[model samples]
Target: MPGLDLPAAATWGRLTTFLAVYETGSVRAAADQLHVTPPAVSAAIAALDAALGTPLFGKSGRGIIPTDAGETFAGYVRKMLGLLAEAAGAVRDADRGRVRIGAVATASEYVLPPLMASFIDEHPHVELSLSVLPRDELFARARDHAVDLVLAGRPPRLSGLVTNARRPNRLVLVGRPGLKTDPLTATWLLTGLGSGTRDTALSLLTRLQASPPLLTLGTSGAVVAAACQGLGVTLVHEAAVRAQLDSGELVSYTVPGTPMDRPWQLCTTSEPTSATRLFLAHVCDPGRVGAAAFHTRHRPQG
Candidate 1:
């Protein structure tokens, strides 16, 4: 039989079905969306194949995967769907106002709430969505248009974004209540095994000429917990474990001559939307003190 042709056999429904399976990568999942049985969706795929004279997907272990051709096609399909959604929204919407913000887990939990609360109070009608992710994920999401802004510790270099909310992060060493250390101890416990903190700690160690640390942790909170159990010494953000310090569960140690500081920032893509601008303005307003105010108001008694 001669190969079937697109003009003779194509339909919008077949394209929609193909795109659905392509996006989700499963026949059963596509079936769930169309409210049909898996076999029915498979039949649609068969019809689409006969019409295009090419296979779109291959069956894998309990799932479906798109062919290379289908993968390329799916990209265009997603673009089309996005454009369609945008067009439909443009026609029906009057005020398209929503800000999606991303932050690292620590910043989201400890730093962003007061800023966000102030923003919402200023613009009560604006919708807000906040995602608490890891450092890399937060920046990646901002790059990919998934979020309007990202707030995290300032990385060395970020492409396609501007540093707007910059502050000097106060980092300090913490140890158990009675764990004594000489001014020139060789051993250390570096918080965050990740590269940025590791590099910073290594530089500090190099300057101090201290030996490699006994432990390297992946989180400041873990460092605090370990110190509480008298595990070892670790460096971390002062704000992160401030409560523990005030309660005498952890105590800050002076680093002799080293200034304990790191830089933090709020980042947004170069071409920020109106929503992003509003959020940035509210968070960094000079006169609008939120968390900074709270910390100043209830500073721990010396």
Candidate 2:
């Protein structure tokens, strides 16, 4: 049996080349990023295949498609690179006091700016890096120790993490200013595919069991845009549509007896780090309240 030399067994050059390719998905692009010639990138890949005893990429029309082994290896490579970057970030933070935060797009757009602004104003020396991702990515980044704090919806469950509930977000129905009230047959506007908004709309419709209504949009933005254009009624965040509602560009509707409340939560890994604690303090403060107050003030007096 040939003795395995671990150093030779793991192809570092090829791994670097592979990461560049996997990230950019183009050999030429990877070469450009690495400041190497295309032929050198190709050679590194070939060397990697020789060391691993497997073909990595299969040529397609113009670009290359990763083989199954390549696909699996790429996943690990991404993790490894992420870990390396995170370690470096941790070292840097120790020297220069910084906080890293991750958030889902909705939270980033609607929830974070004000709280983070206040945090920054108070602690300007604490550098901040906030990345916006989808839910899965947000949790994965938090789980992987890539970020110090995660601002997002409550995950179904938590492991190696703790969460604190923040101000809740209300999902409300919206329509153009002149929308007529016909409870029996109002054309319901809704969000597009693969969105939680769409899912919420579907659930509400199912619960309400109104006649299968029209499909007027393919995205949450589309739903709002269609509503603005007077196409149909749609569901949106009360805060997000506040300006339009106040300006008479849009109007809100209540679900009669059912209120849709989705709470936002801030999460941190177990053994809350100083950065996480500080961010949590800021986000959880009563002064950092969301637009719930706006909804309360505008709601018709009973």
- Candidate 2 per-residue lDDT over residues 1-302, each given as its tens digit: 13434247445566779978877889999999999999989887776677667878988899987899899887676666555655555554342456778876566766678777877887776678889766656667676666767766555254776665455567788887655665325777765454566666777777777664576566556677788887778777666676788898987767653346765667767754555556666655666544421121222222
Instruction: Tell me the alpha-carbon RMSD of every candidate.
Output: 7.0, 5.3
- How far is 187's C-alpha from truth in model 1 (Å)? 7.9
What is the alpha-carbon lDDT for the whole of candidate 2?
Answer: 0.68
Q: Write the per-residue lDDT of candidate 1 for residues 1-302, one digit (tens) a residue.
A: 14667655445566678777886888888889888888877877787678767788887888778887677766665545534433343343223467778776567767777877877777776777888766776776666556667777765255886766665566677777776655236246655544355456677777877775467766666667877887776666677788988999988777754446555677877766666666676665557854443121222232
- Full-model lDDT for every candidate: 0.67, 0.68
Off by over 4 Å in 1: 1-96, 181-199, 202-219, 255-259, 290-302
- lDDT score, candidate 1: 0.67
**Clash pairs detected, candidate 2:** 189-233, 192-218, 192-219
Top of the candidates by lDDT: 2
